[model samples]
Target: MQWRGRRQSSNVEDRRGGGGMFGGSGRMGGPMRIPVRGAGGGLGITGIIILLIAAWIFGINPLELLSGGGSLGGGGGQTQSRTVDTKASDEMTQFVSTVLAETEDTWNGIFQAEGQTYKEPRMVLFSRQVQSACGTASSASGPFYCPNDQRVYLDTTFFQQLDQQFGASGDFAQAYVIAHEVGHHVQNLTGILPRFNQMRQSMSPEEANRMSVRVELQADCFAGVWAHFTDQKGLLESGDVEEALNAATQIGDDTLQKRSQGYVVPDSFNHGTSAQRRTWFQRGVQNGRLSDCDTFNNPV
Candidate 1:
């Protein structure tokens, strides 16, 4: 990806080596057990059922309730911190910062063209666990963007998992991960996320999951848009685009579910299938237009 010596983002907050208690715990179960690319922590089936009942009785958005009230806090109690190789961690940090800076440049120009101010979101680099406005999350939650705090939380170790576990190895694949989370931040700013959260309050779990697939696919498309511009800047090397496509395919809900459990539940999918993800991403890459990335209004 030729990212070295690039401008690193100032919005990066290094929280590595910081010890914290594991506050929020529960897996949002499906065959896809890895970290998702959106806001909030995992909610088990029990948690979902409880939240749905509570939301129905109180007429509140479940997502808002999941994100606890009050300012964001760091962990309150001590836990054993994960050991990280300092030099390797530093290099990974630089790589993420550079990728983030590139996304900023791409989005800033696009927003300017539309006569809107682009508020760049911060990226929090954590080791084992970190506290967010949504809740406390461990590295197992993967990389997620919390709309409550408008920051993207990432664990560098996930990059290794993407390569070794998912077989989506490449620098561009890593960049796609960061860009996808940042795309969620863009959705937050554009009011798309807020509307989805509000509307999902009344939706059945299946219906909500359907809508979620669209939301996630849109983010994937937005990531592709960023890539289009990045490529225009001559930053993309040979096979870069293919790397991102492979990453998208590797993380598709259907693919993950099949790999993890040897089956698939179409109704349980929040993220799109591999083909859907790749199609939407390619649509964006082909045109670099936000109009082309409309997964909600169009048949995705």
Candidate 2:
């Protein structure tokens, strides 16, 4: 987590001011604010998750729900907006950029060793709400990588949610989140995403969710691969690895579901359990090889 004085990534797209024609991002070819209705006729957290995942894996827009002047009816039709103090966010922004740059360095080296070129993906920084090829998303939707857009969308506020809501702390935990998303970018670049999507299309919801768990666990392992490189370069300090493991444990689908719903539903888990996540991540850290990060072929 010793990121100070390190190089920052120029690939960061700052849409915090809501600049550009498409709400905030010039690269996204749509209006800033699009009306969306929550499923079950309620605008709840589940609604945001649906919007996010639809955009993330399927590249489909769920705005059709709003075509009938539908309502996010569970709560009052209120959009959550907060005036961000740019000055206060500068440090966190810098830290994220630095981690991104390091990830680029690590992946670039690994790819080169295999006679391949690594295509560095861009990261979009937004606040409150943002638009992408995936669709518009509220901060509530959390950080996601859209395979179609080849960019990672992050709302910095999620870092706060990680600490206050999930009980995951430390700068290394934040780096783990970014690294996990970048891991998805790696999967996309290597053509894993398209094949996975094709395979998911013919499966039942339960089976598809199981596939998603494998996908997420693989990303967690890839994050550990990046950590392996970071540690080799003496970037990791005391307690850094523990921070990331704590993060993986805290955000397990079973843990989150149990916390929110007061029950666990295994059939609906798209991400692996806490033990699975921690084990797969450790596998990557111990081997530091792409072959070892294959969560699909190997047992979780």
Candidate 3:
């Protein structure tokens, strides 16, 4: 986690001062929409009927799609605005830039080895709410990667929440979060995410959730792979790997459900269980091989 003095990524875009065009009220009214690639226009009556039929067949709540709530499976809602600490915020920005640069180095080399060009994604730093190609999202949505725009969106305060609320502190844990989203960028480039998005349209909610767990776990593994290479570069400090694993555990769908609702619903799990997440991440750390990070073909 010795990130200071490291090269910072120039791909970062700062959009913190101004509120998004959607406003900074953080109140989400109107119809909810999940930002899927190639998604546009209003749903016609026939489209609604199809969605209803799909929900009926898939055993999912039709309202989730209609209301635009849990269709994509990440938390998002109103978040209160807080005063920013200028010094700390700037430092965190530097830290994030350094981590992103490191990821670029790791993935660039890996892609080159495979004779493919790695397209580095831009990172958007926002406060309160931000607009993405996928749509507008609040800080409560946490850090996310928009396949539509191929950019990683982050609210640096999430790092504070990860430490205080989730009990997953340490710079490495923060790095893991950034790396996981960047991993999605890699998946998007490799056609994995595009294919998944296409196939999920026909899949039931349960099926989609099952597939999502694999996708998320694969990202965790990719983060681990980044860690492995980072460690090789002598950047990892003692307890760094453990910090990343602990972050993975804290954010596992099962763990989050248990913490929020005091119960676990396996069918609704899209991010895998804590053990599954840890196992996949460990696999990546141990092997650092893309072949070993296959979660779809292998049991996760």
Query: Considering every candidate listed, which one attains the maximal TM-score?
Result: 1
* True lDDT of residue 155, candidate 2: 80
For residue 49, give model 1's deviation from the true position in Å.
35
lDDT tens per residue, model 1, 128-216: 98876666788877888776667787878999999998899999999998998888777666555655665676788999889888888
Clashing pairs in 1: 35-141
Instruction: Give lDDT per model, in order.
Output: 0.73, 0.69, 0.72
Which candidate number maximizes lDDT?
Answer: 1
Clashes of each: 1, 1, 0
For residue 41, model 2's alpha carbon misses the true position, in angstroms, by: 43
> Can you rank all candidates by lDDT, best first?
1, 3, 2
What TM-score do all the candidates reach, one by one?
0.80, 0.77, 0.78
Candidate 2 Cα outliers beyond 4 Å, as residue runs: 19-89
Tell me the tens digit of each residue's lDDT in model 3 across 1-300: 988988888778777864565532212111111111111111334324434544453456666545434233222432334433334557888899899999999988886664546778878888887876666777777888877667788888888888998899999999999999988877666545554665677778899789878878888888898999999999999999999999888888778888887888899887788899899989889968776676765777
| Poorly placed runs, candidate 1 (over 4 Å) | 25-89
Instruction: Locate the minimum summed-lDDT window of 10 residues in model 3.
Output: 33-42
Order of candidates by TM-score, top first? 1, 3, 2
